[model samples]
Target: MGQPSQKPPSQKPPLQPWGRLLRFGGEESEPPVLLRRRELTIGRRRGCDLSFPGNKLISGDHCKIIVDEKSGQVSLEDTSTNGTVINKLKVVKKQTCPLQTGDVIYFVFRKNEPEHNVAYLYESLSEEHGLAQDSFEANKENMFHVTKDTSGAGQGDEPQFLPPLPTTQVCFEEPQPSTSTSDLFPRVATSSMEPPAGRAPPSSPDGEPNPNLHLLVTDQGGDTLSAPEGVRAVVEKPDRMEEQLTCCICQDLLYDCVSLQPCMHTFCAACYSGWMERSSLCPTCRCLVERICKNHILNNLVEAYLLQHPDKRRSEEDVQSMAARNKITQDMLQPKVRRSFSDEEDSLEDLLDLSDEDSESSDVSQPYIVCRQCPEYRRQVGQLFHYSGPGSEQRAMQAPGDTPSTSASVTPAQDYVCTLQGSHVICTCCFQPMPDRRAEREQDSRIAPQQCTVCLQPFCHLYWGCTRTGCLGCLAPFCELNLGDRCLDGVLNNNNYESDILKNYLATRGLTWKNVLADSLAALQRGVFLLTDYTVTGSTVLCYCCGLRSFRELTYQYRQNIPASELPVAVTSRPDCYWGRNCRTQVKAHHAMKFNHICEQTRFKN
Candidate 1:
């Protein structure tokens, strides 16, 4: 073949620098991703090249990007639940749309989810006839050098040298005039020159120095010339003395001043008292207030100052009046006492008697009263009573020593009644009837009633184990068996210990109880009585002979091959006809004959 007559060498086309740079996470987020590949897949799935795990609205296979290398064109196709948006417009699903430089892409149309949106900054390789790539590489190198130089420049006390950054021409829009005088100067340009040594630059009419450089010359005597009289110096005035003494809560002059302990921060007694009910921290320093006491000295001083300044007295009176009204409203909303008993006729007498006793005594005279709800009693007399309801004469006639029983005829006026008659109080946890305190006191004089730290309700330790057990985290008395044991001790209603134990056992083995429970409940909900325990040991094994043989012959083979663990522990199918056949009896007979195991139908309990 004449050594293959020398053919002309073909020149390879120059590799195009065209690629899409995806800028995601907005301005305050992470850096963008530079896509060098011709194809890009975006979705929540791990297989996708660009995954958006933070976007729960996105589907598993959301969208795809295809780049045409020859044409330098890029396109995106949406295959997601919410679909995608291009340049603020929704893109059709499964349809490719060409994307250009500066095109914005949103995974979803939801304006609330800004994190899923991205912008594109395209760099066309063909720009400047292939000179774009060379310029980009040079600019990137310059940026790297600038970054490295600036990072190490600010370390020493002496200023380090930095290469001057390349300058570019900036265009400004036409300025519009406004009422403000500052708006007149809108085109001030910056200069590289510095002012002369030792002399300060001249300031503008606003008294602020001009940010731009200005040249100034000083005389031989070194005396500086003052700026033109048009520029006036601004002076700030001191705040009025009364402004410093204003209470933060009422925003007025302090009255009945009370100082919070530890910090000694003062506030109006009524304002601080109401605030202390919600939080025990000082309003100023946020320090814990162990206690708050009336600042008599400060109170007298403020009083004297107000007396000297009569104009402020009216404002002080208005604030004090408002505080008083707020205190009254709060008192009305919160119950003075948490009634122990529910609405019932038999408990009406005891509730009325307690209310009567409370009304008879002054709140200040009584120490803290331990009630079902409130731990303290400091409200006005009779505030806790609800006496509008009809009284029960039968309950009133009954002796105090008699044990009260729930009566159908008796009805209570209020929702809560004092169930405790004389000394008989109900258990806060279990609601179990406790022995009379009079009887208990006679039996053991030294023993006293214990109280729950959380509810602050008194419960007898002798009746319900002990109320002293408290949680370390909150220091609150949480019933040990109920909270600590997850209520697995059958203390709560409908508690199933067996089910709980099984769930705990599966959880310990790395199996989720929710999955197992969901699967089991689904079958039960479908009315499927078959009890199938799919253990870790895959599927049940079947004999080859049984597979080929008839149903009658299969029974004998099933007996020989079935495992003990695979056998159903219980059946839930009805004994009556099911699908025109007795499913319960059939399953029972089949299990009994095949595995020699007894089958008992059981009811499913939640």
Candidate 2:
């Protein structure tokens, strides 16, 4: 009975291979194509419903773009009195004008009453009015200084100085690339200097205006763009914008973006996480990579550009108008039908409204030390190390057991004020500025009170303690009940090689003796130490083939300049900097030529 239904091993099943396979995710997964080449935006923009409510500037067919398939043209329509513009070109009412690549379409909207500044879709090019007239490459960040009205209330709108940044480009158009076989990508301007010097003017063959700002004409097939000399067309060139400022991941115009580094390619915020999930390497440049670490500059840059895009501003207006209109409609329908809030609901709302946390002011104190080693080692801490003292630099120069805490000769307590200490955490203690209480608060503030490094969860340190590697090296809190001070390092078991285990554990966790000693008591709690070997090991290996190093590595090595016999052979003979692939080969060949037994037998073939 069990074998009755079984088919013979040689019998083939009936085949029906007629249905089509819709391939999605797998090895053939869309072939990792650029999002643009697929002719699509990562996400569709949601168009607002027609007709909005109170204080509404424009709604219900407010802005429209009609695409004509026959003519390959796009026509713009704006009900707002100001105008509808694609790029900066004002669209004539019914004209079906041909659209070019990278065109920035914008609409201007001003509310009926004199309320918020006219909610325009796109800002103008005038650097004066923040119009989009500046070169995209040029620094266009504007600065303003605001002053308080001091009427004993709070912050005021009155400004002391409305200072502006160096006026530059609001937008830039990348000229049509040459037809020749030379590299198509725009070459980054070369410089003679790498360190922080100043950018100098480039020498032009024509000896004319700055090429960066000049109106260089481009030949599109036989047709040439014939705008007035120095009159750059802002409206007609979204293609150029697409080329220069597109998100590397989405291939869309960068809305809010962030640049991935060591490879400085920028990608839209939505796309970056996915791209980084695959690999953090910049998609445009095929270079080695690191993780998506902090990038303040790129974050700030994208934030600024997104502030200018008008599409989002207009959408927000639609939602607000609808809400207002609905409120009015409800009031008109039920003038006398007010619903009382439930007692339980009111109680719940009150609890939710209460503040769990506020933007509590913190005293950020900084202390500085001289030795380059400690400060350089403390890049994870950043600017604080520059301004704050008590680093590897300070520790080395200190007298034997010279405590920073004891050094502070305290005066009697005066008017109570908050002070940020030299350590990293914002002062939880008070409202006034925290002083570098180095002598007083050195050891106690090393780490956050009871946070565990593994779980990042806080525990009572009294019960918890270092268990695996022993309490000597692993000061991490764990309980003797949960974990006895069992020594993986044998420090508790008293192994002869316990120091080796302790060193390895500390190196892996970036918690060396020097780091612990230098940290302010507060820093230890928050965990603000560099998670890397502070000691410049035989220098860094930038290019393994050539044995090269980085500026930081050399800086660390030359800093001490230990005698050759004492230092490792690698640190002694390492190449100063990264040699390009070609240069590295040439240099290697030259050196090998001097020590070739094979070359001695066979005359040089190269």
Instruction: Indicate which candidate wins on lDDT.
Output: 1
lDDT of the structure predicted as candidate 2 = 0.29
Local accuracy of candidate 2 as per-residue lDDT tens digits, 268-307 = 5445544434432345664433423444565465455557
Q: Could you tell me the lDDT of residue 431 within candidate 1? A: 42
lDDT of 1 by residue, 1-606 (tens): 000011122276533435544454445454445455666677654456666543334554667776655544456766543345554434433434455556566554434334433434443434542453454333322221111112234321211111122221112222221111112223232222222333322334553322221111111121223333222222223224454555666545677777766687877767766765554446666555555566778767777777777755633444556567444222111123234433432254344433323334564644334432121221221243335244432333222212212222222212222332323355554343334443444576443333432234544333223222341111111111112223222211122322333434445667552334334334434544233322211122211111111111222222223354533353212232222111233344343233222222233422
In model 2, where is the ten-residue run with the lowest total lDDT?
Answer: 34-43
Candidate 2 has a TM-score of 0.20
**Per-prediction TM-score to the true structure, in the order listed:** 0.23, 0.20
How accurate locally, in lDDT, is each candidate? 0.38, 0.29
Residue-pair clashes per prediction, in order, are: 1, 46
